[model samples]
Target chain A: MSRLGRVLLGSLIPIVVLVIYAFATRSGLDPYYPSMASISSRFSELWLFERVGSDVWPSMRNLAFGYLVAIAVGVPVGLLLGMVVWLHDLLAPLIDFARSVPAIIFIPPLILVLGIGDVSKVLIIALGAGFPLLITTIDGVRKTDRALLDVARAIRLSRRRTIWNIVLPGAAPSIMGGAQTGLQVGFFLLIASEMVGASSGIGYLMMRAQASFDSPTLWAGIVLLSLMGFVLNLLFLAVRNRIIHWHLAMRAVSGSR
Target chain B: MSRAMRKSILGVAGVVLSLVLWQYLTVGGPLAQTPGLPTASGTFERAVKQAGDPELWSALATTLVVTLAALLIASLLGIGVGLLMGYSKIFSTALDPLVQFLRPVPPVALLPVALLVMGPTSNLAILMAVVTAMWPALVQTLVGVRGVDNVTLDAARAMVLPPLLIQTRIVLLSALPHIATGIRIAASYALLMAIATGILTGAPGLGRSILFAQQAGDSALVFALAVYAGILGLAISQAFSRIEGRLTRDYGPTAEAAAS
Candidate 1:
């Protein structure tokens, strides 16, 4: 079968399921299920006005700020830790313990300390995102090819110049991979922290809808959150592919061979 | 001192130094002004005390049970689906889009829906966890199965080996290393989801206790519970690593290497 035909065939099941759900609710077979029309209306309502300003925008802002903070701190610290053997050894246990703890656990204490504000949420997201990137970056930097370093030394390159040119470039692929993972972690924590204590944001919106028993609104929040995650991941992938095109090309060649 | 001994001493010193700094900041330094923050010694003492609390123990037990159950379910379903997709090009092509679409959606986003459909129960928590944890195992298994050498399969076919025997002896064995990778990843997700579900729904777990402690302004207790959760995560991950190491010892490290 053609690729398009296979995709259509695969999609048919989910479509049929949705159709059955819509019909079931429309015919009042299940009062709990929100009808398709109501869900769509709620979606537009959120997208057009009420939620866009109050919930979606705030959530996106927090996510962006948190991610930026994570990258800014994680990359440099990771490089230093990875490059300095004594520092790595001294901090290994502490880092392991910190990373093992789930980021959600920190939300409560942070809320207590920072109050129910954007700062707390952003910090939680940053902490959640930072560890993965830090670990990956350290691994990448530590694994820098000895042969490349030797070549740099053969050319009489200074330590700073060697790292700037050879080490950073060599570690770029792993660092980027870490960044991708960190984004996912950041998004998860963003919703989680928002849910725990917040007046606005998609997670808060969902919680409020649930409390009010507004099924359609709740469903709308879920749909919007899913779309946000999906779109952000695609955007990250596009950026990563562009930034590390050479590394990817090299990987492809080696993989095929 | 030898290099290893020096490193060990420095590591211990790092821990001690951090503890002293933590104590000073919360007990006497500028951070002492921060309300509700506990001293380092107080937090550690509370953590030890909390270990004996029946409620805390029960919550921890509930989380462990839910996580293990979810992991088991996810691994079974993931391996089955992965094998099906790997063995059939048409099936894989059909499912690729759906998998891609759903994979990136954080499982926490499904909590409200799960609560609505299933109510706030342990079952709901398990369902959320299973959904979240299944993907890694499924994807890894698919990759492992697809990478199985075609020449070996062709040789088995020429020898007229039974299909079941061929699958068990060749494909499945080759796929074990990759499946192990998936299981390891899924195990972490399961623990995270279990805690998240517990906290969100007040479904009886360490997460709920942590929330309770925070709400009560018992910062020491909160810190203790957080430490327990971290210990649990580390233990599970270490256990999986050991198992994976043994499994991949003879597999030439294809799947495990890619994973790490």
Candidate 2:
């Protein structure tokens, strides 16, 4: 098959199956599948476009603030730890300890310390994103090809220049990969944090729906959350691809990994 | 005794120095007056007191059970399905779209559906946990299985080994590393989600205790629960790493290298 034909073939089968299944269930030949009308109504109710910005904006704000703060702290600290061997050795155990803890576990104590407002939500997301960002950054820096470093030194590159020009670029992909994972995981934890106590945000909205047994709106909240995560990840990938254009990992991994 | 030992000692001292610095800055300086922030000794004492409470241990155990149950279910389903997919390209390609679609959706997003269907029980928590935790294992197992050497498979087939036997002995061994990686990832998700679920639903666990303590403004109990949760996470990860190391040693360098 041609590439377009192959793509069509690949997608067509599922659509056909769904259509058949819907017809069967609707016509009462099958009781297992929900009727097409029910499914469509559910889909429409759960769709992202249905949600107002007021219900969605606070969670996005918290997620953005938390993720950015995590990146800020994680990247610099990771670089320092990676560059300084003695420092890395001394703090390695502590770093491992921090990373091993589940990010959600921090929510309760954080809520107490930071309160139910945006600060606590941001802190929880920060904790979730921080470890992966830091760990990957450190690993990326530490694993820089020694030969490249030697070549830079051979050319009489200053230490600062070598670090800025060679080291950062080399480690960019790994750090970015960590950042991407952190963002996805951060989104997961952010919703839970919002649900815990906050009065505003998508999570709180979902909680309210649950409390009222409003399945449609609850599903809608989930769809909105999923859309936010999906869009943010795509945006991150685009930015990452642009920034790490020269990265070998990006070249070799076919931009998927 | 040796240079490595000396370096280790120096590392320890550095940590101590850093901790001292942290303690001073956070506890004695301008930061000390910050609300909800506890002094080092204060946090330590709080943790110790909570540790003395029997309810703490029971809550911890409850959380552990929920997490373990979820991990077991995820691993079983993930491995079984992953293996089948790995063995058959048609099966994998067919399901690939579905997996891709579902995988991007944060597992917690299923909470609304789970809460509706399962109704705030430990089962709801486990359902969320299973979905989130299974993907890593499934992906890892598929990678591991596909990565098995063609030579090894040909050798087994040449000997006229039964398909089941070949799969059990050769395929499973080849997939062990991927399986281990999946377990490690799953364990992290399971533990984290278990706590999150517990908090959300008022389930019986350390998560509930932490939430209750926090709500009640029991600073010491909150810190203690947090510390305990942290310790549990560390222990599970450390134990998994140790197992991964042992398996890597036993299986050969290729298997070790491929596991993660």
Candidate 3:
């Protein structure tokens, strides 16, 4: 099949399935539809908007905060391990074991200690985000060409300058890859954390919707969460492409298109 | 052996030091008032106490059964689908888009639908686990099969070897590393999804127990369960990785042999 034909077929299947589902069930969903026109007529209608915004903001804030914190902590730890041969040798097995464990495993303990509040949720997301970022950044830095380092040395560049100029640039691609993975995992943990306990957040909204058997609203939250992840991935890719222009991976892309 | 013992002692020492620091920081800090937010000593006590509980052991058994069943089913289906696609271009082409489309849909998003269809059984947990875990195995198997040298395949064909023999001897062996990678990914996904499905269903397992503890505001039990779950997750990952390594060493095609 042609590329366009394949793409259309790929998309068409899901749509067709949904249509079959809608017709076969014919379940009434009229009540679930948002009534934007009922502005001053119903206080309940206004509460929905407030509920959505409030729930969404706290969750988004936790996600962003956790992501930023993970990146900050992970990058430095990764760089230090990558640079220090002895430390790398000693800690590689322990780090590998730590990374292998699912981050959600921390959520229960985190909530136990931090309470069913924003702090535990944020920390849970941070824990989820940290591992991938650290591993990928370490791999990226370690993969930096020895020849490039020699060149820096040959030019009599200061050690710090060489690290800044050569190491960071070389590792940018890998770090970005790690960041992409971390962000997705962070979102996943966010949902799990919110669902378990929390007064606010998209996850809490999902749990609430589930409890109420509000299918449309539940689907809406799920869709939004996936969309957020997809968008973050795109943004990461765009930034990576721009910042890592010197990398061979980026150069290979132009020829393909 | 003595060096290993020393290292273990040092590890224990590090844990103790960290616990001491944690206790000091939280004893009179802002976190002191939080329910279930236990100090280091508190958690240690809970862990010690819970270690002797029959209910905890039974819940752990339930969790293990669900996780193992899911992992087995996922591996079987994934490897089958992946091998079929890897060996046939037409099959790969047909399935590629479906795989890509389904890959990014978060497993948790499918919980409600699973609940509706299956209505809370071990089978429901199994179904959720399979869907979530299958993609990685399939993708990895396909990649591994594709990585095998065409020259080797051609040589085998030229020698009039039967297709079955060639696949068994060459393709399967060459694909071991890729399959291993897939297994590692699938194992972790299966573990997580099992717990997720269990929690969602209020089923008999560590997940359900954790939720029960949460509702009762039993912070110590909750933390103990989380610790056990973490240990379970770590054990599964480690065990599979070791198996993967062994298989890769035994079956993965060597670069020197390929070059020759």
Candidate 4:
């Protein structure tokens, strides 16, 4: 299809769904199904500028802190473990057992132990989000090509230089993939922790709306979240393309996986 | 020692060492004074005791049932939709935007909608799981369908194979490894969402048990249930991953385009 054709075709579903929803909800038959007009108005009222500081900022900040911490700790440790076979082997069992437990399980105990503070929320997000990056980084580093290492060694490349040039670049695609998942998981945990035990943030806002049967505001929260998700993904793709344009070009040449 | 032997020894030592550390911290170490946290031995013993209780077993059954039911529905619906979307470029182009728009929205976001609309039932959990867990399978199958070799399809057509037969024998087979990856990930998502629903909505499951244990101030039981839930997740994910590994191996990684 032509570029214009693709855009028009892609836009078709959302437009149709919106039109149908708009007409159906305006009938006012079901209270649970809020009208699009009201929902959008509520969306603007709740998130446009008012709650952006109080609710949205807190969630985003928590997600940022947690995600940054996870990456900072996870990447170096993962790289080291991946490089050191003995250390990885020694920790494999423990790591596997721990990772198997979904990170959400910690919300209750963490909240109970540490109280419903930002510290608990941040820790919950960090612990939950860290696993994907950690696991993928370790695996990615381990998958670094032996032939590349051999050539580097034959050339007597310094250890530091070899890692900077050969190892890191080769592992970049995997780490990049891990980073995307890490952020997605981080967002999931962020909302979940807030929902579980939070007094502020978008999750709290939506939960309160539900408790009070405020469908329009609740629906608005969903819209805000979906928008957040869309933007976050776009940003991730931008970073990914910038970093791994080479890998992507290779894929484009070879065709889709 | 042989490499494999040494590795196994290290693995065992790692597990034992962690458990010892856990025991030390909760039993008499620095963290021993931490209130409501159970000793490693206490948690393990509680797990054993919980196993004997029929109520706990019922809770396990509830969670597994929800997870399995969701997995089945999600797999079937996802593959069906993915097939349609993949088979028709027009359909895929029309729907891709809507799908992509929602991709990053986590399943937890649906908690409010489901609670009001569906009530805090196991069905609500199933609904969440289906919505969330089905994505990986659907997305992968869409990719898989697109990745089917054109020449192979043409060759099959030349042999006078029906379109249905071609899709089944050639396209589906070629895409089986990718589907396996999807299903494995889907299993993890399904279980996670199910337990999460329980935890958040007070639905009946190990998650609710944890909530109740905490409320009752049974820290040891809470810790034990969390441990048990971890084991359950580990077992389910390991089983699926092993299957995925076998399928990918049997299909040969070098075959077609490899799944990312």
Best by DockQ: 4
Model 1 chain A worst lDDT window (10 residues): A27-36
lDDT for residue A240 in candidate 1, whole number 0-100: 91
Candidate 4 has a TM-score of 0.95
CA RMSD of all predictions = 2.9, 4.3, 5.1, 2.5
Candidate 2, residue B163: Cα displacement in angstroms equals: 6.3
Model 2 lDDT at residue B80? 83
Q: What is the DockQ of each candidate?
A: 0.64, 0.45, 0.28, 0.70
Q: How do all the candidates rank in terms of DockQ, highest first?
A: 4, 1, 2, 3
Estimate, for each residue in B49-84, the C-alpha lDDT of model 3 and write its tens digit. 998999989887877787788778888899998998
lDDT minimum window of 10 residues, candidate 3 chain B: B110-119
Compose the digit string of candidate 2's lDDT tens values, residues A1-257: 46675466457657888788666777533322345665457657544345445656667878889999999999999989989887787787777767766777677767766778888888888888988999999999999889999999899999899889888888888899799889888888888887788877677777887777666566555555666666776788788888887775645665311
Question: Which pairs clash in the backbone of model 3?
Answer: A113-B37
Model 4 docking category? medium
How well is each residue in B1-260 modelled by candidate 4, as lDDT tens digits?
89999999999998998999999987788888687767889889999998899988899889999999999999998888888898888888998888888888876877898898988789998999999889999988887888887777889999999888998888888788888888988998898888888878787777788778767878888888888888989999899999988887767446445543
How far is A114's C-alpha from truth in model 3 (Å)? Answer: 4.1
Which pairs clash (backbone N, Cα, C closer than 3 Å) in model 4?
Answer: none
The local lDDT score (0 to 100) that residue A69 gets in candidate 4 is 92
